[model samples]
Target: MPLPWDSQHFEISVGQIISPALTNSELENILSYAKEQGYHLIYWATCPDRMIPLPLLQSFSGSLVDRKVTYQRKLSTEFTFGEIKNPSHSFEVIEFPRSQANQQLKTLALIAGAHSRFHDDPCISKEKFAGMYHIWINRSTLHEIADVVFIVKNSANMEDCLGMVTGSVKNGIGKVGLMGVQKKVQGQGIGSLLMKTLHEWLISNGIHTSEVVTQKNNIRACKFYERFGYKLESLQHYYHFWVQL
Candidate 1:
């Protein structure tokens, strides 16, 4: 599919291959079509069981950028919110107005996408990559992309946001759009508090399941979700193919 948002933002024509698997001949045809349409880059994602061969991909300049993992948790009847244990610092989780925390949230969004696929791809410039996250947070604050946003603040100094998480519910399932804890205060249980707050909000809205996706290389994120009872749902390999035209 044509990625108008990404293309317009990065000033390059971009598209994505929607098929899970493609033969060498099929890929050639797709690339031809992309070039004809003025596409400079194309993204393709494939499951492990249906991946295109490495040799064939290399022939077209397809570079692997990320191994995406999706984790899920069912909010079962036995599920309960555990108290956030923070011996080092006290925190206050609040559902602040989206407009109130736009700047702080945009900073956290940069941290969240620091090691993302866009950042890893050499085809994307640093400024453009940062701009991508900025646009994301801006849309999120407008409630166009995220339904609700939660931030954790130091109780003693409510002006400082230590962590933040954005969530949305659809079809009775909750999805975490972006989440991050400030670097200096990462291990202080602030992330856990933000997550707990999001879960409570989801459950109150009748959402019984939640899912999050992260890069496989982000071990800390994977472990964090696992600690919260989120199980592995699926894994996919992401590749960025830059046309030589």
Candidate 2:
């Protein structure tokens, strides 16, 4: 006598999870839809001799939206820290909210300060300096930290600006900009104090790294950072390129 057909062997095909109530054909369609729609799918190789679907948790960080919208810096830094020899000259560390649009003008002027120092060099003449500063204070500020401006001052106004550091905040990373003390004030302990404050702040806040960049020609700034303890992270030959895409 001929045996009746066994329905348990049938497969479903509608991209839906199968249950004991679902015929085998319906489960086949479900898997087909899942694959076509880019949904992840996995099942255990053995679970009491039966396969069980597993959950999938894919990362969104490397997706197109995340990758296309992010920017990374190519420069390295030499870290520094003060040994704290009595805290003789006291300084105040202040944090400002960069939320106010008007504050952006101050930010631009600060960038101008750095650019002005290099204006005479042919490699970064006045126009080039200004353009570079503009790009830094504008687009790049959105990447790292949220524009924290720290300054040291004393008798004789900001002329004794001692030192300054600025950068944007992102995901709690510290990417500092060395608006290094101008040509006049070189070894007045300003750089050390600034780095010390930065170190303390970064450590307290659980920031992972404090990175700053200085031109290879600027031996003074490079040495200054080295005295603090920042190691040479990397050597990169960077060129700025623009495209209207």
Candidate 3:
């Protein structure tokens, strides 16, 4: 079902539709109706284990956006803490202020790299990506939606933002929402320090398990989380359909 606030079109299928030919026609009709209603983009996701009708999917001129895998790390008393290295790259992680939403948005907009589907999609423009990033960072300000948000900054110059992480607690499980490092300092261990600090903070808040999701094609992100003891839990795929109206 499409959310009332969603502007894009969505269609979902479940429990085998038996007749492939009929299913394909129905899907085509749905797309036509969506186009008539001024929707240029559509999203469709299916059960990971179920057999997807390739002919039906290929019938549309859309692209595969992501193949994501979920990973979880369990905190234990035996866990060890490592030193956040790189003295030349001294930085601090501080709780983000709601008053500084614009500043945060600007920093995130400059992020040249992302592993997520939307950012990696060639069809999506940088302007659209920045708009999406703004919506994401501001979600934490909503009541009961996020527990904490921390931003990484240069210790020598506190106002200079480097990276940020958002987390939430649900049913006693801590989940990483969004985290990214600036492209200029990406490989200098900033991302590692950010996750390490976030893990410690989660543990102190009584969270025994932490989880994060990243596209399987994002090798760097997957490797980074695995180094922090996060194990793969599950995988899912999603398709993105775009048509010019």
What are the C-alpha RMSDs, in order, of all predicted structures? Answer: 1.9, 19.6, 4.9
- Cα lDDT computed for each candidate against the true fold: 0.84, 0.42, 0.68
Worst 10 residues of 1 by lDDT: 76-85
Ranking by TM-score: 1, 3, 2
lDDT of 3 by residue, 185-238 (tens): 777777777777778888899998999988888888889889889999988766
Model 3 sits at a Cα RMSD from the real structure of 4.9
The list of candidate 3 runs beyond 4 A from truth reads 8-39, 47-55, 109-113, 141-144, 243-245
Q: TM-score winner between 1 and 2, please give it.
A: 1
**For model 3, what is the C-alpha lDDT against the true structure?**
0.68
Q: Report the candidate with higher lDDT, 1 versus 3.
A: 1
Itemize residue pairs with steric clashes in candidate 1.
none
Candidate 3 lDDT at 53 equals 66
lDDT of each residue in 33-59, candidate 1, tens digit only: 787777889998888665666766665
